[model samples]
Target chain A: MAKIPIQVTVNGQTHQAEVEPRTLLVHFLREDLGLTGTKIGCDTSQCGACVVMMNGSTVKSCTCLAVQADGAEVTTIEGVADQGNLHPIQEAFWDNHGLQCGYCTAGMIMTSVELLQRNPNPTAEQVRAGLEGNLCRCTGYQNIVKSVLAAAERMGG
Target chain B: MFAPEFEYHRANTVAEAIDLLSSNPGAKVMAGGHSLIPLLKLRLARPGVVVDIGGVAEMKGITIADGNIRIGALTTHWEIESSSQVAEANSLLAEAAGGIGDTQVRNRGTIGGNLSHADPASDWGTVLTALNATLEIRGPGGATRTASPTDFIVGPLTTTLGETEILTAVNVPVLAANQRAEYAKMAHPASGYAVVGAAVVVNVDGHTCTGASLAVGGAVPAPVRLTSVENALTGKELTFENIEAATAQADNDLGGEILGDFFASAEYRRAMAAVETKHALFHATEVAHH
Candidate 1:
């Protein structure tokens, strides 16, 4: 099979690659670009472990194809932190103990980032509804909601 | 499952996407990939070419004009769930959007893809049918056709969409005054797809039901309007006893029509559908009362 040539902007950098048409965005991020921060928990698209921001929206990277993301802006967990500073969501998660095994942290943070950007002051129910797609097995998500609430309060909205 | 190896093409326009599909005998359009990718991986769909239409400029936004709402094929479920316009005009759509799969799925699943995919367990299908929405499709020769939600889906994982045609948009009418709707579902824990779901729309006239539409999903091969239940509810006052009695008709109406999978048995789903219908009706009545 011939590889499809496409351009995608990951985080803040643009990269051109000739990838197999069947190559998923998760594989492209982890293997080709070596941005291994995005974890792949399930290929069946059930788990939110592969969530990444595509054009400012969070989508399952495992389900999306690299070719499908042509010219699309993507932000992964690696992009969440800036210049040695953690994003408020990331910091809140740490302070609130939102993770135990940490497999779902990346996707959770990415999903939370997108949710808060759209909704500055989300209630606990709203946070749960917004993050329902991202699953965490180890933690009960009580702390995750708390972290989001803390971040919302810190953001002053 | 990984998708079978296939050629890839990115179409920037609806016409180009249609042409690509027409030219390729076994080509499938790729939008959000939330639905298609899994099928491809399972080898359930073995297209020779995968047309990436996610970036098609023509199929990308939510437009409201002339008392109608037009949603492009590539509009993600998240966009609909969060769109102030949809929330303001058609709250049922937003509520349905909020109930689909989860955050990741909502962010990537397209309404066009979901409708075209036509999974009976799909949350949006039930709500759209309850709303009497229309699906727009464009074919090889630039011909367009419209199918009501009831006519659009044929069975589980089946639709009226032709191989050489692409779903362009979904057009929905604005809700009328005193009309309210709701979707209720009992979802399978892991897949997040419904085990049984119901969508109810009601038009109230000063605490009396003037009109009612009910549709059942995740219980049959396709979501179907419950005409028997609607008939029972019409002209009836909004009351818990009335709604329960009317919704119980699902047990008789959908007994054999309900689908069975590893997640649930047909008999179980039929029973659950009745409960979901009651819940949906209750919610719809609440909305109408408000």
Candidate 2:
């Protein structure tokens, strides 16, 4: 198969590469770009472990083809923080004990970032609904919801 | 979980897309890839070529003209869910769009792909059928045609669309001042696909029902318009008892075997279809009264 050229901006960095047509966004991020924060949990679109923001909207990176994202802006888990400091959402997750095994944290945090951006002062039910796509096997989701609320408050919402 | 290697063609225009499809008989038109990509990764569908229409500028937006809401084929589910215009015109469509899959799925899944795929449990199929939405299809040789949801979807995962045809847009009738619609569903917990989804649209004058459009999905192979329920509700008082009685005919128009799975049995789905129909009707009536 011929390689398709693509230009994608990730975390304020623009990278140009030629990849196979079958290369998924998640694979291109992890393999070519060495950004392993975006985990491939289910490989299927069902698990939101591969969630990333594409053009300001959360999308499952495992299902999005690399060619489809050509010339598009993508923000992965690695882009959430400022330098060595953690984003407020990440700090809240740590302060609120939002993870147990920490497998689904990256996707969870990324999704919450968009959720709060859309709804500054989301209710408990709204947070739950917003994070419906990302699932955590550990923590029972109680602390995750608390983390999102704490982030909302810390952000002065 | 990697997809098989295939040729990729990004069409700059609708004509280029149709031409690619016509030339590559084994090619598939990919918009959002929420449906097709999964199949590709799972090895369920193996096409020789993939024509990516995601960048086609003409097929991406929502507009209202001539009393109809026209949605471009590439419009994502999240766009529809958040569009204030769509909500103002038909809140039921917005509600249905919001309830599809999950937040991530909504961001990438397209309404045209969902309808063109014709998944039996797709929420849009039931809602679009109830709303009497029409689809515009473009094929090879610059041919164009329109089809209703019922006429376009023939069976489960099957559509009347030719292999070389591309769905360009979907046009839905705007809700009248006296009209109200709602979609109610019993969603499968894991997949979020509808186990039994019902959509009801009614035009009421004072307390009398002047017209009704009722449709159900996930109960049969394809989304079905419940004419029996429509007939039962038309010209009747829009009361709780009358609505319940009318919804009882939900299964009367169904003619084929109901779908059954571990999540829901065929018998349970049949019962829930009627229950959901009643629920949708009650909500639509409440909205109408308000």
Candidate 3:
């Protein structure tokens, strides 16, 4: 099968790619576009390892087809920072030791950014529930919850 | 993991979608792709043509008509979880939607797809069954048939849906006054698949049960309403003792083999079904009384 031409916007930049019809969004981001920040831990949807904000909502890019995202805006972990400055969510994760292996950090931070945006002020339980999709094998999720709360506080949520 | 080669057609309308499906025997509908895509990747489902009905906007929303709630087939779990109408009219549905796989899965997974797929462990099946929800289906013949939740689902990963049939909407009655319901489940840690789940509905009349509906999920090839439990609870006082007695049939009702893995044994899931059934019934009774 010939590759389909898809137009997508990622990290405020528009790009065109010829990809197979079955190409997953994660591969388009990592392999085609050369944005390798999004890691693939488990090809299965169980791990939140490939999380990305698509049109303002966090989704596992691995599960999303690239063609399905045609004309849709995407934000990877690389796009979270503004003007070379770390986003508040990133700073909170770093300061609170939210990650251990750091493999799940990008997805955790990205998912948390969207979570805090929807819920400015969230309880610890809310944070846990919000990030339930993203899994961190290293951290017992205690610090991740703390990091999300800390980010909310920093954002004056 | 690349899916097998297949022609893709994005159908913008139900009529067009039906036409596409009618043209091929192995055409499959894709909405959100949360369920179908994984099957494609696993090679468990190999459709000759992938009909993308996700572009159809008409098959979406939550509407109230004639005191019945009509939810479009494409309405995502996130939409249902966040919709105030769902929360107000049918809080049990909202609660079940909220308990699905997770935020990402909820954002993309549609209730209609979930119900049509008829996954036995899905949250929607147990809750919808307890509510006696109706499925509005459209097929190649352009005829619409409504099936109750119990009738819609035939078995695991199977439904009454034909090759050219597409689920259009789900209709649920606005719960009667003084009727309360709750869903309780023991979630599988890794995949978030429910090990044993139960949805309990109670109608209270001055401390006496006027109506009761109990359904169990994640314990068999399909979710089933527990008539024995319903009989035990009906006309009984809303009390913890009554709830426990009613829930005792959970194990007996779950006579079929349960899907088990390293996470839980079949026996464990059966025991948890009774436990969760009791828990759901207790909460439903509490909500009805107060």
Q: Pick the candidate with the highest TM-score.
A: 2
Residue pairs whose backbone atoms clash in candidate 1: A133-B103, B1-B41
Better of 1 and 2 by TM-score: 2
Residue A91 in model 3: lDDT:
93
Q: Model 1: how large is the Cα RMSD against the reference?
A: 2.2
Clashes of 2: 0
Report, for every candidate in turn, its global Cα lDDT versus the true structure: 0.86, 0.91, 0.86
Name the candidate that leads on DockQ: 2
Q: Which parts of model 3 have CA positions greater than 4 angstroms off?
A: B255-262, B287-290
What is the descending lDDT order? 2, 3, 1
Q: What is the interface RMSD of candidate 2, in Å?
A: 0.7
Q: By TM-score, highest first, what's the ranking?
A: 2, 3, 1
Q: What tens-digit string does per-residue lDDT give for candidate 2 at B100-219?
A: 999999988999999888889999989999999999999888899999898998888899999899999999998999998899999999889999999988999998999998899988
Residue-wise lDDT of candidate 1 within A86-131, one digit each (tens)?
9999999999998888999999899899889888999999998888
Report per-candidate DockQ: 0.79, 0.92, 0.68
Native-vs-model 2 lDDT? 0.91
Clashes of each: 2, 0, 0
**Model 3 residue A69 CA deviation in Å:** 0.5
lDDT string for model 3 (B1-290, tens) is 87888777788999899999999888888899899888888998888788888778989999987879999999999999999988889899888898899889988889888987777788888898899898999977688898988888878898888888899999988887788889989987777877888898888898888888888888777888888888888888878778777778766677666767677777788888888888887777763231
Which portions of model 2 show Cα errors greater than 4 Å?
B287-290
* DockQ order of candidates, top first: 2, 1, 3
